[model samples]
Target: MRSSLRPLLVSIVILAAASVGASSARAAASGRPLGNATRATYPSVVSIELLGRSMLYSVNFDQALNENMSAGFGLGSSSMNIHNTDLDANKSATFLPAYFDYYFLNAAGSPYVTAGVTLILNHSSVKGTDTSTGNLEIPSSPVMPTVGGGYEYRSDTGFLFRVAGYLVAGRSLTPWLGFSFGYAF
Candidate 1:
């Protein structure tokens, strides 16, 4: 089982790296579109959000596929071990999202909508003495669909801010809110 899992994990890492490299290469090979760049400086951003009781951090890298269309990769974890919980279990999960975004209202500083799939890895540990479940750790993978919309604000100092909200549909359907601030190249 260990040998089989090793290959699967390696493949997943390689595939993710390849996808990012491909997108970057495409973006670089193509020349900037006419007046399409706008004030949006960075194609990628990292956002940290507090989902009510849970905490999440994500890094989103985006590439403009065309004038009105863009795609991005969101990678992050929702559950982090900050302390020991006597009553509750310690849980953690990471999400990889491949999303398509549309800049429908392309005004000076307009809003947009994004929809895509989130491939998630969930892990949990009930290592406390609260329940019969002993030092426990489990991992699983699942894919979910999400949709979100937000406004983009461009700053004079070559920085951009994007705020968005997305929902994942599944057994533990989670809702996440994100705000990313970054500079363009």
Candidate 2:
């Protein structure tokens, strides 16, 4: 009975979120065409995010395939420090991320789920103070898989705002929370 209820609860939650995007009520009150509130008009979105799927920050571009689906890619960079017992170092890395987003509606505001992978290219600009412990192990490249969900607000005039939480999947799961500001032109 408990297991059976899980799916039912999830369905209810999804339906509730989708219902928030319904514009018929707003249309009736404001006297505008409901057709205007859709992804059909604006199919492309460009955004800049902090601590997003890139695991740091990114400038992203996405094209909507339909009302519910989108695909995109991003470029980002990070300056990190590794301070520990064995090694102390600071490095700059570049990240390339690719992802897809599934929106619950085509309205001005909607809920969305996203999945992506990021390729990290580690640059050889390591700065450290403790070299007596023989600091040597360095990773050339690494790829991480990520998934998350969030809400997006897009206006008819092309303004957009988004917030999301992401999980990096691997031997250890790392969680990241991010937000973005962009346009949907």
Each prediction's Cα lDDT score? 0.51, 0.65
**Candidate with best lDDT:** 2
Model 1 local distance difference test score: 0.51
Candidate 1, 42: how far from true, in Å? 5.8
Model 2: which ten-residue window has the lowest total lDDT? Answer: 129-138
Against the true structure, candidate 2 reaches a TM-score of: 0.68
How far in Å is the alpha carbon of 160 misplaced in model 2?
0.7
If scored against the real structure, what TM-score would every candidate get? 0.56, 0.68
Top TM-score: which candidate number? 2
Clashing pairs in 1: 41-184, 42-184
